[model samples]
Target: MPQLDISPWPMVILSMIAALFYFIQLKLLNFTFYNTPLSKPMKTQKHKTTWELKWTKIYLPLSMSQ
Candidate 1:
């Protein structure tokens, strides 16, 4: 039978917690914020083409007798 030693685990856990707090403090101290410029509404134009103004017709081959 063998016993596992975990005496160093407490020190490691404390160091990790200290590092987390240090990073959190740095993030809070160096925080920056900026306001975005407001965008203006754009105007849309409506126009018609020459093709739409002319009338078109389509003939079917099945309607014609042979």
Candidate 2:
């Protein structure tokens, strides 16, 4: 096989653009909602358990360990 070479400029430019967009969004949200509190307290949604949580807990690393 002939030697193959690849350039990473495209990936670098894409990631930089994505990061810039994220920062701009964060700045916009901060400016619009800096002092406003939610009118109502946020409620946590309850999920029905169907063995998924049990399996994940058994296999996944615990936060305390990390």
Assess every candidate by TM-score: 0.44, 0.39
Backbone clashes per model, in order? 0, 0
User: By TM-score, who's the top model here?
Assistant: 1
Question: Model 2 over residues 1-66: C-alpha lDDT tens digits?
Answer: 986655787899999999999999999988854677669987999887887555554455565553
Q: Lowest-lDDT window of 10 residues in candidate 2?
A: 52-61
lDDT of 1 by residue, 1-66 (tens): 889999999999999999999999999889876789899897886678877898877666997976
**Pairs with steric clashes in candidate 2:** none
All predictions: root-mean-square deviation over Cα? 7.1, 25.1
Q: How accurate is candidate 1 locally (lDDT)?
A: 0.88
Shift of residue 20 alpha carbon in model 1, Å: 0.3
Per-residue error for 27 in candidate 2, Å, reads 0.2
